[model samples]
Every structure is written in structure tokens, then in C-alpha cells.
Target: MPREVMIHPLAPAGEPIPLVLVAHGSRDPRAQASTRALARGVAAARPGLDVRSAFLELAEPTPAQVLSALRAGGAPAPIVVPVLLTRAYHGRVDLPAQVAGFDCAIADTLGTVSEPLLAGLVRRLREACPEYDAVVLAAAGTSVASGRATVAGVAAELGRRLGVPCEVAYASAGGPGGADAVAALRAAGARRVAAAAYFLAPGRLYDTVMSDALQAGAVGAAAPLGAARELVRLVLAAADAAAPQLALTAA
Candidate 1:
């Protein structure tokens, strides 16, 4: 009793489809710079592929602006990849509303617990502290239950991969902040606790969490996963998977 789905070529004769990486925008300059860097990395990985970066809010060149420019340049409907790690508010509502008028295929949000993404987290954590017995996956918390669940899942998997107990902490919204999480881990008999930033770019929330963690006796905190090689791979994979759907939608 299910409908069948058809996949089509991205263009009339298999022309290259533009990929737009949409990030949760921030007012912080570092956030914008980090996103632009990610766009560059994606562009570099696929030599001739068109890769563009746009923000959903609090940043320049919104998704609509990017799509309009692409249309003006005679490019076909693009595959919009939400560079989000979870299907939170931005991914679920804001992004869809932003691109509603555009004839583009909206790809799935880059999930939290992808292998490459976990690998990137490990890489960043290790780079921050060579040895740590425990970690706290600090995230910009969301009130949505599903989003919180995804973040918790990421924490468990990350802990398993690192062979340490990882706890989930929030930087904003409603939850235990980074300091409290670090304190809990310490009281739970974790000798050396580190905070792994569950963010795609450097922003106010990330800064606050990292600072709080460090102040609360965390050995060190990993930086945001900005322009990391693993992230680049994930972005490309998302675009490729959505290309056919985008073509179908455009048809």
C-alpha cells in the first residue's frame, strides 16, 4: 500500500547540479567564516561541482538569495543540504520556510551519529587532550524531545568509540549546562573529563559551553567541527544522495 518513488537524472542530460550547504546562521563573525571555509572545502573536494553556502538567519546571503542568484545564472534546481547535525527547529521549520518558493530538493540533515561525524569528534577531542578518561558531548540544546534524543544518542556512540563515558550537556535552552555536566562526571569518579563540542561552527553557544566546561575543571574542550575533512565527505554524500530526488522534484 505504499507509493513508488522514481529517481531521475539531475538535469536534462546529466549536467552538474549545484549544491547549497545551509547552516544555522549566527551573528558571530567566526561562525560565518567557518561556514565559508566549509563551503570552500566542499568545492575543493569536487573540482567542478558548484558548492554554495547560505545561512538560515543572522547571516548574509540567505537561502532564498543564493537560490535566486543560481536561477539568474541559468543553473538548474539545486540540492539544498542542511548542514545541521540534528533535525531541530532550524532544520525542521526555518529552513523549509526559507526555501519554500524555490524549486529545490531539500536533503536530509547531516545526522549526529554518522561514522564520519563521530570520527571527526574523536579527532577533535584527541587533538585537544591526548588523554582523557571521560567526555561530555556539549550541544546547543533544543526543547524538542526528538532533537534532545539525537544528541543523547551521539553522546553514547561517541563514548563507545572513545572507550570512555560521555555525558550530554546543553549550552542554551533548558538543560544542565556544560559546567554542571562536567561536575557530574567528576563526582561520578571520572578523573579527566573533556568536553566535545557538538557544533558545526564556532558561535556564541559553543564559546559559552567550552568556557564553562573548562572552568568547571574539564581538562580541555574540543573545538567545533568546522571545515573538517570528515564533514566535507558527509556533505558530498548528502548532496549525491539527494541529486536524483532533486531532479524528480524539478521535473
Candidate 2:
């Protein structure tokens, strides 16, 4: 049989679906737990989707393991939903490699300018600390060319939404660090800037980002989109995209 051949379900269209929610796992248990929460939230919103969480690395249930589970369960088709915020190595290379010879399409990552996503952050910021004058989105830098593009894309969207300049910075890897973002805000004439750490959970990176941004004169760091309802919508959108062609499936 040729590769990329997805099996059809004998069950009706209204039947539930099997899905894999992939994440760029971390050594931090909170990170793993957060992904688990995302999968669970997706499942809650759409009971029709059988969501499963898997890590790209440094966590259990790798993509290969997820594929095995799907195949063993005899799922007609399984959609791979990446929990990543950007299309870096895990999204471009590691993810595709898992399904290269296998059957299934991958959904897009949690790219920056998510309308509901950004709104969610705004709301969270307003509730937590309304004094902030600007929002700074910070992520771990990646050497990949596409990674920078992803951040730029998100920053542009955010910039448009807030009616103020939104900036991007990195906590590590190659990047314009968070401090750089603060400087840019200052240069752009922003008086008070808030840091929105894009990290999923608490760990060394998360601590470093928060500490540095706050010390660098940021108002405060907003919460990560951990189990946010808007994020669930984005995840579902990705799932629908990767699911086999069916006009009724999205309904």
C-alpha cells in the first residue's frame, strides 16, 4: 500500500474522532502537564474529538508513539494538532518526519496573531494588571529561519489589534531578547510595557524570562495560554484542517 493513505471510517460522519495533540515537550513537569490540560480542554469543548497529548521530545508519548496508538485503535484517520506557538524545528522537521511514510496531515502551530488568542491575553492582562501600557510577547529563540518569520507574523497581528506597537523577543536561542523588546517599546515611546511570556509552563526558561522582563522595567508578565478556551478553538481549527475532507465534519 502507498504511504499517506488514510483509511475511511465505516462509522457515520457524526461519530467522534481520534486526534493527537503534539507539543514541543520540556523537562518541566508543568510543561507536560500543561499540554495534557490543553488536550483535555480540546476534548471538553468538542466531545466528538478523541484528543491525545504527545510530546516531540523530553516527554512521554512521542509522535511515533501517538501514531502507533492511532493505528492500533484502528482509527479511520487521526489529525495531528501541534501545541507549539511557532513553526520551528519541531513543527517543520521533527513532526513531519514522524508522519513522512505514515497517514495523516498536520495542523498549523499556535502562531502569534491568533485573534481569540490575543484577545484572551488582553483580557488576562486587564484583569491581572491594568496599568500596563503595552504588551510584549516573548518566546524562546530558534535558529530556524521560519521561526523568526513566525514571530514577525504574530507581532504584526498584535500590533494591529492593540492600536499600539506590539513587540517580539526571545528568552534564549537566537533572538532579540526580551530586554531588546523593552528598549524597542521605549524607542517607540511606550511608557509602560507588559511582558507576555509565551512559555507554556514554569521552568528555568520561564523564570528567566519573567525575572528579566520585570527587572528590565516591564509592568508584569501575563499568564501563558494554559487551558485557555480561545486556544481550544485554535486547536480545533487545526484539527479540522488536518481531518480528511468532509464538509459535514466541521459542522
How does residue 228 of candidate 1 score in lDDT? 91
For model 1, residues 68-98, the per-residue Cα lDDT tens digits are 9999999978889999988989999999999
Model 2 RMSD, rounded to 1 decimal: 6.4
Question: Each model's TM-score, in the order given?
Answer: 0.94, 0.85
Stretches of candidate 2 exceeding 4 Å from the true structure? 1-15, 245-251
After superposition, the stretches of candidate 1 with alpha carbons farther than 4 Å from their true spots are 1-10
lDDT of 2 by residue, 1-251 (tens): 11212332223444556778888888889889888998888777764557898888888988888788787877755678888877888888899987676566677887756676677666655665677667687777787878888777777777677677778888788557777888889888889998765655556676666667778888878777777777777787776665654334433
The local distance difference test score of each candidate is 0.87, 0.73
TM-score of 2: 0.85
Model 1 TM-score is 0.94
Best by TM-score: 1
